[model samples]
Target chain A: MSDAMVLDGARAEGLATVREVPAPGLIALKGDLGAPALADAVRAVTGCAVPGLRRIEAAGAARAGWMAPDELLLVAPREAVPGALSTLEARLAAAHHLAADVSDMRAVFRLEGQGAREVLAKLAPVDLAPGAFEPGELRRTRLAQVPAAFWMEQGGFTLVCFRSVARYAFDLLAGAAAPGGEVGHFA
Target chain B: MLLLTCPHCGIDADETELSPGGEAHLTRHGPGATDEDVEAYLFLRDNPRGVHLERWRHANGCGKWFVAARCTVTLEVFGTYPAQTARPPQHVLDAIEAKRPGATRKLPVMEGAR
Candidate 1:
């Protein structure tokens, strides 16, 4: 298999990657995981303590935890992604946990900068703030009504959604972030 | 855009994840309580105050009903707890069994009913 791949989209610019992916702000990590290994995997990705993955705010990363018993998502920095997954899988395997390559099955995206919060508000109704969502904090919510996993980092937000709805979510975010759009109204 | 601090779901949920459940830790004045007590507990504090503790529901999220501590004085909510944990407190499983004898409904029936 090729190391990288890309899927073309309705918009000519489309998307490109060394690995086949869903869309922007989408990340997926699937494995033959149970709760413990999944927690270790998440810690590997976010570098945060995981005890039942409680709902508490993090110092720097906006994190939202979603687990399907074994499968999980650590939506954070794309830059930290490669190392994150490798480290996570390594940790899980070392502990004798089952894992699989879900990178192709999941899509990841990065949304950040000054207008990042505004962009998020258009899709989610939560008030994104330091107190509400400190860095490292994670939440599983809907993006434009689509179920998604979200994480907040230094100046941006990252998310992973179902592959099928990746395009719909992308279109919604793109439209929301467009100049003179609803998100623009908030700005 | 209010940040409802849920004890179970933690913070960081959109308003859509929760529904306003009115004030927090409120109690009835009881039978034959003073008129002043009733009024104060009933309709006296609708006005926003600083540091108010209110009740909220994690409707679409964890499905756990809990109390939210807010600052009506400041309009800031910083914490939450399970619904039965509010003030008056509901009887526990043991207490219910002892008092109502067969009060516990079957899980499947309750689930379907809800």
Candidate 2:
């Protein structure tokens, strides 16, 4: 099989740096996420605990975040996705849950630097105030008109949107990240 | 744009992240209900000019359904609550009462109904 490609090209020219992470392993897990068996199974596979509502937990390079009351998104290094998914599926076979690999179903991008939050505020409607959305927090919200996910890390923020609209999301981010596109003071 | 706080995720979601679910706290009419009752349940709705209650889903956020009490004309939101409950909570009712005195506490009855 041919090697999979990553959406890595971006044109960020301002304080914001927009670029794709390139082929991170993504797994969608749905079930009683609070259940002991499911939580243990997920921890076993990802080496992290199931995050609380709107929270993300990370161990090494793998991270798990709550998507809904019963759903979660597991992100790991690209090379480790397939193995991690199989291990989760096998471990949670008897549990009332679903574990599926969704690495290619969505594209992940990291938007950081000085005005990352400001650039994102132009599209997403949720409050990006430091106190409201701190580090380790994730939200399933919209970017402009498309459905997407947002999470904060050490230096910047990460955005995950459907692969179908990756271009639109990229362009929007690039435009917002341009020199004159500073949010609330655009010229 | 309207902004609603999702009871599930505690996020103040904008109208873009929310989907309107029509009127809230409607009685369900199933297989055993009378014909008129079923008709009222399905077709009848109270589009009051003030102090209206609505159902809204956080479509892009937590994906949980919630209820909101707001003014139809002024667009002032009283409060939001979880959808698992059959009716609006006491705090919401209190807020409405505080805003508009003598507002009807019960659901509006259909015309020509006993």
Could you say which candidate leads in lDDT? 2
CA shift at A23, candidate 2, in angstroms?
3.1
Tell me the deviation in Å of residue A127 in model 1.
0.6
Off by over 4 Å in 1: A1-48, A51-101, A182-187, B1-7, B12-15, B18-114
Q: lDDT score of model 1?
A: 0.53
DockQ of candidate 2 against the true complex: 0.69
Considering the two chains of model 1, state its CAPRI-style docking category.
incorrect
Give the total clashing residue pairs for model 2. 0
* Candidate 1 second chain TM: 0.53
Tens-place lDDT digits, model 1, residues A1-187: 2222133432211111111233322234555444566566666566544423433333245232444323344445445556665776676665644433344455555665556666667777666655666555566666766676666654666666556666676676666566554444334
Q: Pick the candidate with the highest TM-score.
A: 2
TM-score of model 2 (CA atoms): 0.88
lDDT of 2 by residue, A1-187 (tens): 1123245555465758988666478888999886888888788878889898789999988899989888999988878877887787787878888888888888778898888888887778867766777788988998888899988887888888888888888888888788876555322
